[model samples]
Target: MAMMRNITIGQYIPGESVIHRLDPRTKIIATFLYIVLLFLVNTFSGYACSALLILLAVALSRLPIKYILRGIRPLAFIIILTLSLHFFMTEGHVIFQVGFLKVTQEGVVRGLMMVSRLVLLVVGTSILTLTTSPILLTDGIESLLKPLKGLGVPAHELAMMMTIALRFIPTLIEETEKIMKAQMARGADFESGNIFQRAKSLIPILIPLFINAFRRADDLAVAMEARGYRGGEGRTRFRVLRFTYKDVVALIFVAVFVVVVSIYF
Candidate 1:
């Protein structure tokens, strides 16, 4: 599907804007704080502030609005499912009624809140992945989780796995596209089926996809081992990460934003 190529949630775009220039650790921490605040928000005013923050970040990233927003498309089904549940199950003064089912004023408000929360959450995280490179993201995560290494946690290993997973998203999508084209060449009918039939048609695609994925994983492991790779013990990075003045400013902004949203918004 052409729509599959448009998915950019886990892909990084190369840019020189302030957002892309900031240290990955700063972006990661700020995103975590923003998500925390999003969960705390219960009012439209709070969501307004949140929207402003995400918009500001998007503007600074110097990325096309469409590219950033396209990441939300793949999530449309989940968003609709969540909104439907809240709209139907929440109870208040009935706004509309059909048979035994009622749409209430409270349901409408709650559904709106859930929609805003989900949108903000997805957009905020997408910004993180969009600006930061996979390598930097891994380093940032490993550094942050360095504290947990004291408790027998495999911090570096976990970070490596997470980084590989994120890095594989675009690769897997591209692979799927190739497989689809190959199947289409072989008279596979992926587009002419109903819901269940369409899903059934995907069996041919899925079989090769899973096989290719396993093959790639094995190849990656072999390559790593060939390079004398072992555990993360005493691993040295060529690019040493440091906190710059921009990182300090970003942290201050997050702190102020969190305080304002928590107490005032």
Candidate 2:
């Protein structure tokens, strides 16, 4: 359950900071550019700059550093696994060996690079979700995809699906936690077990979790229908989105950061 609390994805913290006040579109575009630059850059110095940008943004947002770092804890295993893969597979001068397994100098360098990339990718984009509310995020996505509608894309539906998926992540985690506790009270052993045994023990939990998930989804659909919520066709928003000077400034800042890091260090 503590692991669930550390997940910052799909979670938003309200604040009066400039980061929070910028249009969601600006945040979304900046996040996209940041992610693109992550893959394009090949140097540790570039990753360092990316890390500093995230840190500066976090400070400007008035959010606790620990709060932002919490998001990485849940994905720590994946990061470690990624490092292991790079460290073992890349070929170079042998640095260490164990019973036919060789660790290379190039592998160490590549592994650390991969680890840096993964960490920055997570920390950089997390700022967007931390500062922007789900509703505004959905609107921003839809607005950005609006141009694709002329090319036969279901922009509104696509945005709705993405938003719903993200919005339900916390809900699903809470539901799973609840079911696990309930099962534990009934003497189910989910803890002390080998890998296989632990996975097998989750059967009782997954069954009821899926049922509750589907039931909730159906309930939401019915409620929407009852409220006359048809497709996004001709739909009007209660809160309209507008691009202001703040958004322009935010874009310019991100553009400069991404360009400088991509071309230089």
Candidate 3:
């Protein structure tokens, strides 16, 4: 049996909260700066400040904290692997030892920092997708990149691809859940095995999933072609984007937070 509802990163939940109403460009810039801030911070205090900021954003978004945390479940394997590698391999004052493995004070601290970075990164991104509609997100990204088009960049195409990719994440998750359930009903085992065995079991699930994904993609391309769809050149947008005082305020807040935290925190 498999469950898929917990994954919320790629799905949008329409809301009337202030955070949701902010300009998509504002949110996009904020998310990007927040990720950069994550890598810039080197102290526990910096991480704490970053966590506080994320919490503030989450509160403003009015999304359920528990619901937001549910998205972290899918990253358990990566988080665990990160913790294991850093906690056991980093050189520092040894805090504990067992058999051939040991934990160090620095390692523990570094592992916690890395985990915090990952969680913050995920929550920040999840909020962006959960609050902004896909079409709006694409518009914002294109708008931001529009200035780069003079350098031979395909701004609209890049934005469309990014938005489409984000939009497909939830679709892929649902597809995976369906495939897993269908396979399991046929007596396929995905859980009752060692790590390597479990990974091997997933091959059956992934192969069909990829095939289905490609099929859907091909159908989408044909449908677009039939509808007279072309590249980004001269494409007119139905919903035009404009900035408000709120957008300016949001951008200022993120910039100040990043700059102050990086320089003074």
Candidate 4:
């Protein structure tokens, strides 16, 4: 059987650690900078430094190591595929050959490096989302994009939409699972069927799912209007976000990590 779809972007866990307490804006900026720095890193030393920083962050967040690794389990196959392609396709003095396919020392090195980069990229960003709440992330995004309001952009509206979408992902997933189970109970065998049969079986689940989704959209619209929701006009937040000393310290640490990694590269 296929594994259940537990892996998602916003797998947040509430906590009171230093990393958890930093403003969401700081985490967003730091994650962006970290990704940029990952590309700048080319040498083993650079990778080592980046790995150390990720580990430090993971430890500080106080989340279980297994949970973090589990989040990346879904990406394992993609990482393997990437490594395989890089290993077999790149041209060099062949270390080994299988018919027309050749493998080289450079290919091996490049493949390993590519896999490592992808793993680090996923795990590091997972840390950001794992610690910060989706609401905080959306709020930070709106605050950061506020300057665009001068250009007639609807920053708050966009952020609100994103927040709602993020909020509903798990709910939708659960709904889908329930629909699938209900169909299964009615002898809708999705697993032991031909392609056409499987497609036909899904129709029952899809129809109800779509109808429910539309109903949810309509209800949300009505609720928003009932609450006097306007498009970012003189809106005030219930929880006013403020940057604290932890944010400053996290930025400083991030800057140092970038500098050290750059030097290593």
Model 3 / residue 117 / CA error / Å: 1.3
> Which of candidates 1 and 2 reaches a greater TM-score?
1
Model 2 ranges off by over 4 Å: 1-9, 96-99, 162-222
Tens digit per residue, CA lDDT, model 1, 149-183: 99988899998898789789889999888998899
TM per prediction: 0.80, 0.79, 0.76, 0.88
Where does candidate 3 stray beyond 4 Å?
Answer: 1-9, 161-230
- lDDT per residue, candidate 4, 22-97, as tens digits? 8999999899888998899887778888898899999999999997898789898998898889889888878999
TM-score for candidate 2, please give it: 0.79
Q: lDDT of all predictions, in order shown?
A: 0.90, 0.88, 0.88, 0.87
RMSD of each: 3.5, 3.6, 4.6, 2.6
Error of 4 at 159 (Å): 1.4
Residue-level lDDT of model 2, residues 92-164, one tens digit each, is 8999998888889998888899889988888887788889988889889899999999998888998788877
Q: What is the TM-score (0 to 1) of candidate 3?
A: 0.76
Please write out the lDDT profile of model 3 over residues 38-95, one tens digit for every residue.
Answer: 9999888998999899899999999987768877988999999999999999998999
RMSD (CA, angstroms), candidate 2 = 3.6
**Highest TM-score model number:** 4
